[model samples]
Target: MARNEFRKSQGVVPFGVGATVDFENESLMSAGLDVWPSEKAEGAAWLKIMEATQIADGRLARRLSSDLKRKIEFFLSPTEAPELTGFQPQQQPGRVFMPFVRFPNWYFCPRCRILKRIAWNTQSSPNAAELKCSNMGRRVEGKGDPCGSLKISRRPTMSPVRFVVACENGHISDFPWSRWAHQNSDKDCDGGENGSLYLYSTPSAGLAGVVVGCVKCNSNRSMAGAFQKDVLHRIFPSGCPGERPWLGPKGVEECRDKIPQTIQRGASNAYFAKVVSSILIPPYSAQIQQILDRPDIWAEIESLPTVDGSVEPFLRIKAKNLGVDPTLSFKQYESVAPTARWMQKAMSCRRKYVIAMMSTRHMEVLGRQSLSVTISIRREFPSRTIRIGSDNSSRG
Candidate 1:
């Protein structure tokens, strides 16, 4: 779940595509609703669909594709639709679907901090629902519960551990508790059936007091430097495990990037959504625009005679047929195409300038080192008159 302060400051909750959200003791991604079923529901029904007008931005709308542009335009524009009883026709005018990803139904007991998988739906067996620690019967000095007996807790007492392992390439997965605790210079626990791991937290609130240990090999490691940069690589020289839990159980990839431990799901560096957007420009001229709108007419125009055959006749004929002015000359129609082309080029240049300006402004605002680049354009013009004398000003 995103922090309340972050959501408030952002003025919008980060619940769109590639967003990480916590629900039912699990971290999940918001999948695109376009992949959802039209009739039957496959995943959880926790999403609340709303109108797209709430978060609509003109800048974002300008970047939409033709299909999405048409849909959003239709929704925002006034149009008539059939009215139904007990429902306002304009209540939910738009269809902007939210994306979601499947999350593992796992939980950790607060007292023991041992990981456990639970069912997706616990309402059916409410009376039998409980998380029991694996080390319930194990006895050690100052270890286990206060009585050192089997520990049982209600479902509410368990919460999902907020820790997750992430790489610089944006791959995220559950923390490697078994590998971190067992695989070390002093101990080489294979994490097989014989290896069992447990987490312990001291009275100190800092991460220095947190510990992970393997019960079988008696190997333990502290969480003190886990949050430090490149510390995981130093501890486990094998590099990241390339785990992508969001993609499911078998979605592992080959990644050699440094993996860092993140303590909270809502951390600023936890998830980064990669998006690419474009601005769509419409045709400018009504005469050429009409021809471009229909592929058949455009193809016919391309197939016309080219050897000294004037395009004015074709333009005039097409313009007359399309109810446009027959007086529209080829020169007038041809000039409109370049206007649109120049507009597109200008838009591209403006976008680049805005991005560079924003980057410079951000560095200045944060009092960081300002990166500057200098570019010079040299042009040579033909001299109208050349001096024969080469005393000082003449050069080859």
Candidate 2:
């Protein structure tokens, strides 16, 4: 295991979460470069680290003074041309908090069941952050403490974990975020078609970093989004979404004029009788005959010609809610039309279902799995439904 990693009593590291920082040496005066063997060199010259007087203090000091320090400071100051983040004392340790995460179900993976038992915050170290393991994943070699899905590399010293995501068409990619976010380097390999994978770049052993790949459409996105929300809570941006709606509740404007109005005429009117048989609503969305005796705002609606074709409902959703009385202005009321013909249809069908397909790589439910759920009785299947599912990724 890496000397710098934190481990728990169970001997595991919190794997597959966003706790890692994009740490680079970013040093103005490299201490180890001068000590490295001669074979390693950059360009046509050996790596040269400007020499400085090295000092040691038994206690960590908030400030220091030295000839070497002054020269380095001249170039490394915050305002300097090559300014760098000041050196931090490596001896000081970070607080080792207990950690746990929740993941999705992986019933489809039999041989990889124990992969879930892979290492976690099992031990603490100052030099390394990982433990060497024998866990060769199904697709990748190195195993995560909880069974890894890391992409593999052949080089041992450069032991980077590649996160390869495969699309349905078999276009597999190492989801390297630095390459993706910065759009620099490795132009030779495009993410390929149907780029649905998300990339998380993190520090590894040496030279290179590890990349954790995930699909945007994985059942675990919500779970992962939740886990990430807390992990990067301080750094997360606004408008962030939870497991479901990132936009939160539907607003009144969103429901514009979708709620139905009372009958324009009295409930006993002939026109009311003609349309009475055509109305279908769940008990929650409907009421008794007397309730309709008085006009709702929608009941006052004077012949605004119904838009032709499929756009009739667009008026309710885009502009206003269903009328409360026939006289109500088209712009007056707003709502998610629970009583619309389509909404009614959506609420009633037994065989009907809704799914949120993934953004990348084609995936489907296991053919053998069956799910049945009862919801408010509706008239027709909703034209839209969101997929609500999850997978085997750690959550906390």
Candidate 3:
């Protein structure tokens, strides 16, 4: 039996799309956005994110919303739904559904330590996928060994290998097993692509303890220095195939990183989300922003006359349509689509106010390589005084 659970903290960093999650002795990859149910996904927040990203960087925004067209979804959990006592809505049971597929399809039998790569149907649900020790209760003949034949008695649960190959350009694939085992040795694997590999640990502690052996050729190799940077490049000369298994079987692309780096599944640099954020200032606050974000409202606002500060009157009407407080004074509502004349007047007034406030504070004059002085005087401010001289123009 398998259980699926998600933590709120995991949604942002490690558990996003293309991320590999090791859960309950299984390594599963977070599926692409296409698998997510539309009703369960949050659209408004995503739209806002797209808008904010567009405002920050148009190219990146287009890539996210138009080019890839993959929207970031916020999955709703059971607790998020409010319980109505008297009434029942036409809704199903509240449980978040996020589809995950088995990644790095390799698994090892714990009892025999025999490494096996299982062919899992990507279109099927991960819940239906099961890993077992098929070698259990089977008689196997040991070739060219002192112990000629042996019978497998014990049945043990299989575990996913910790090792995987990845590139800097976000492409990941299974580690080269047969190639690594027969790398330096003269023994050639007879099983070819379907070669049976076994992963057994010695009495030693870390990677030194781990050994990968081919059943066909009896050539075994220790997993020493497997986590090194450029080790996989020596094994696979063609470099990273740009395989994006998380996106699906057909998600392969041309990768820029010629040589793929070997890393554990839980490595920190495995996945990096490129996100752009925009901080809306002044006129784009709360209710006003909501209205401005709407193309229809903005179009109407732009079409309205700006003569004699008439934009304020039109904005007030739009704000009312958006359910904004009608009782707010001119100062409170001034920033929302204010007219050009009003903007100039407001800026002038604010500059005057700032000059008045700063003139009262003590001005510090510093002499360095480049000298500058704060000349806001209570005496000289009433009169228009523009000091053009630098305070400390001489170098030390």
Candidate 4:
């Protein structure tokens, strides 16, 4: 029976998609409370498992089933949908193609209120023919266009699509989002604000490669893919995480340090990954193992350390290699985009002191030391401001 339940549970998931993430995990991980809230913090501590996984590795959300997606979106509907009751207008898009690899923001519209997925693509051709909605479309009254709009009501969307593997044939097997939408899309949905509807949305190349087919075929294809993944993990040079050997932050960096840290070989990524992992994730393994634990993830982190947190304006500005000419002064930016684009890190401050979120760009030179390239991150995201409390320099 459990086997049947497992199969049923797996039926609705979408394959080749980024894992769903839970904010709750971030909170728990941040505090070093690794045990699942309900379980007693027992034998094998969660910290050990985390360190084993490399504290730097991102904790991806467990793969979700398509049915789970629907349940999640349904719960998110209320604030997203503005028009609660109606003869029911605004038909949903069937097989909607989101242009962006991963959309940053997505939600049901509050004004018109329907499950709407935003497709941000500069490549959308205005001259290209409009793709008609698969279901009934809205028709024109005295409208100039001959093809009238059909009021098909709703189109099945990914928010509720079951997470299931695609068979080689390209059909969605097990549970189907299409059939489910036909029955439930019309129900009263009162989830939440559209902005909050989908926070875990990540961009990927898989959806762009999607090929439609029958469900039975998709199931077969998915199983084959899963089998292949297992094979690769087993036969590859590195075995699944084990005691035989180690290649984590300390070990990987130790090996890399021997090669000598340099941007030339890209060995520095391992080091940076370690930094990102430490700051972003909880000190899972480090604390548990009590081995080489650096509590202040950014102990080495420097943000133009200020003598006073509340310094009014001019405190002691030590400018180094800052090519700012005496004639040039602060020119208010016309558009924030340019600022954000020119530099990757932005400037944020604690008080009057301006802190630059700049990283050193190690440029290798033949005989001399690696040149440091200072980039302006503020130029990358111009919309952001000092209030963001971040420096704008970023070294690519």
Candidate 5:
């Protein structure tokens, strides 16, 4: 972590959910999104976010609103207990928190060089936030000589292996440790895929210095060809398994890309986030949005008759709520619709324009045309159109 990263709040760090983060103990873990919290996103801001997401991802169009509710979340921090109350506040399970799962669970103790894999699924698994070396220097035998002996003193800290496999489809999984350790040798180990592994590294040799061995069979192989594009394919023919650990324990999806390339956990291309921004128009804009955002006001507007004359009375009474002069003539309402019908049409047009702009691959050009159109609307119907500014900082 950098010195400036410490100044930012938690959850805002580069280790954002789904990305692996390096710990102080030289451990690496991927952040997971916690779903125990009951908080749901509401108000116009959330609607705008959902709208943008829907526009960006067509697959989400068929997804129910409830299913898409998991995207936005807020984690509440515990506050100090009141002085006079003499009570201590405790953290709750549902109080939005992010959980981490240790990826590349294979860890090797520096002192003993004994590699170990930690249990990730069980309740007794070590906390993902903090993982320590579990090597107790237990006695073990190998084919050639004594593998390891009991420790005389304190246990050594374990460090995570740097290698992990990921595909272009955003699926990531642990590196094939057991396969790499026992490959190229004819000897069979006591445990086929689940065998005791050991790691030895010679810094002077760089990547070639790293070597993985099976303690049971005494088979060892250097990581010389590990970085090759076809090394993983040669080891395992099936291809990527489509593992998505960051979405939770069971977030697997069917991925078409088979060739997963080996990459370091801290590599720049390890993860990428797709972000798209959209402009809110008319009734969704900040100023007028607040008035319609009110449940009572929305319900009243929805129940009103469709007749144009019916809106004049409601607008006269609600004009003050929109920060407009209540005494304005009804003549301006000709250009603007009763219930912002024209604004709704314009909003649809803006969506089409935005989609066209995105198809052109020019995102920086967005909101330029919308701003000019908004200004024209404001000028044409000054009494009806609320002067909306470009700044939506107040929105989430």
Candidate 6:
């Protein structure tokens, strides 16, 4: 039951994918329509038909070949279906086995501060007056006429229990009522089974004033430190029993994490869903495609040195093949050139970018632009000599 609550809190609701509801804690039920239209057989025969048709459909097949240019794919055959029995088949595609089911009919009595699970009868008309407090017997002194017992309305009167117990290891269950009231001292009480338990709140409007008690043993305790970090562990000492009531009786496992109390279902900290996501990047690029189409021109450009002597010839060849401007002189290229040290720094940065892009499994690009660039030199040509006799006509 607690496991189901945890699953519901994790957004696995009824009629949705991954919903498995156990009715009356007797039979495990899943919510999905049977895909096959016949009821001839119940076991392997139904599964074989489902595996051949719905499960082996192209939409459910594995992607085998991907076209880099178009991002299209030729899908392969679906994985071999495992042999299983007693599976509730769904006729439609995308049916999932839900981990838990919803318990929406449960209600709480605000006056008495108790939770009650209400069962609905499909044959009878729904009555709001039928939902009543189980503590009606306590209202009478002895055993008077039970007719005067108060009826607790489902809404605005009876509410769901607002708090539950959860541990650090992701195990959650209903708050331990008997343990809290008995305080680990009464081994003979058998929790609260031997007596009736009552929850009451004082006028202070705080958890410190709310109290839970057993009528038979007369043991009571306040909820003051229930939410305190590691306080429950100190009180109980046994730690969390790893109770997952949603998974049924065998759900209990070994867990030693500290158990802390949490608020109702809708509370922010009640459930924390873990999610993962990634960005999809296209493998093909127009610039890369153009470069690949003319490998000879790319090879010529790659072979050129980063010196001024190579600039003019490289530009002429680039202009003829790659449509770069041949008229642009060496001075133009020199104006944008950096120092040798700066060139080394830029190379280091580019290398890091390349390594990062290659190492990632998803192959995410750094940005929307190409990192390729032509290296430039900033220094003046050493071959050009400075004449001391410059402007002789002006001197004359």
Give the TM-scores of the predictions, in the order they appear: 0.46, 0.17, 0.54, 0.17, 0.54, 0.41
Q: What are the per-residue Cα lDDT tens digits for candidate 1 across 1-396?
A: 221111211111233333466644445554322332111221112111212112222344443424233323111110112232342223323322222354434456565555555443332111344433344534334464532254343323446566666665445566666666755637666642331555677676688778777666778877776676666675447666765553445656787755455545667655433322323232244444556456675456556666127556877887777777656445555644443343335444542211010000001111113221111111122323321111221000
* Poorly placed runs, candidate 2 (over 4 Å): 1-172, 175-326, 329-339, 355-396
Ranking by lDDT: 3, 5, 1, 6, 2, 4
For candidate 1, which ten residues in a row score worst on lDDT? Answer: 353-362
Which candidate should be chosen as best, given lDDT against the real structure? 3
CA lDDT, every model vs. true structure = 0.42, 0.21, 0.51, 0.19, 0.47, 0.38
Q: Model 3 — which ten-residue stretch has the worst lDDT?
A: 354-363
- Candidate number with the higher TM-score (2 or 6): 6
Which model, 5 or 6, shows the larger TM-score?
Answer: 5
Residues 1-396, candidate 6: write the lDDT tens digits. 112212312221221211223332212212112211222323344333333322111221122112122221111111122222343233433222232222233444545554344432211112344344555534212333232263433322344454566655545566666677888455457536432566776676688778877666777888886766666775547777775443343556887655444434334444332211122232333333344336574455446675446756775665556654455433334432333223344444542211000000010011112111111111122334322112211000
lDDT of 6: 0.38
Ranking by TM-score: 3, 5, 1, 6, 4, 2
For model 3, how does the per-residue alpha-carbon lDDT over 1-396 read when each residue is reduced to its tens digit?
243455532432346557777777677876554443223323343232222211122233344345344442112211112233343323434322355667888877665666667663433323323455555322233322221132222235568888888765567788887788888778755543552677878888889888987777878788998877677676877777878776668878887546776777776656544322332234324555455557775556456676337656766776677677544523344444343333335444542111010000111111101111111111112224322111311100
lDDT of 4 by residue, 189-249 (tens): 3332221121122133443222112222221112112222222222222322211011111
Regions of model 6 farther than 4 Å from truth: 1-108, 114-132, 140-158, 184-191, 257-264, 277-396
Local lDDT at 310 for model 1: 52
lDDT of 5: 0.47
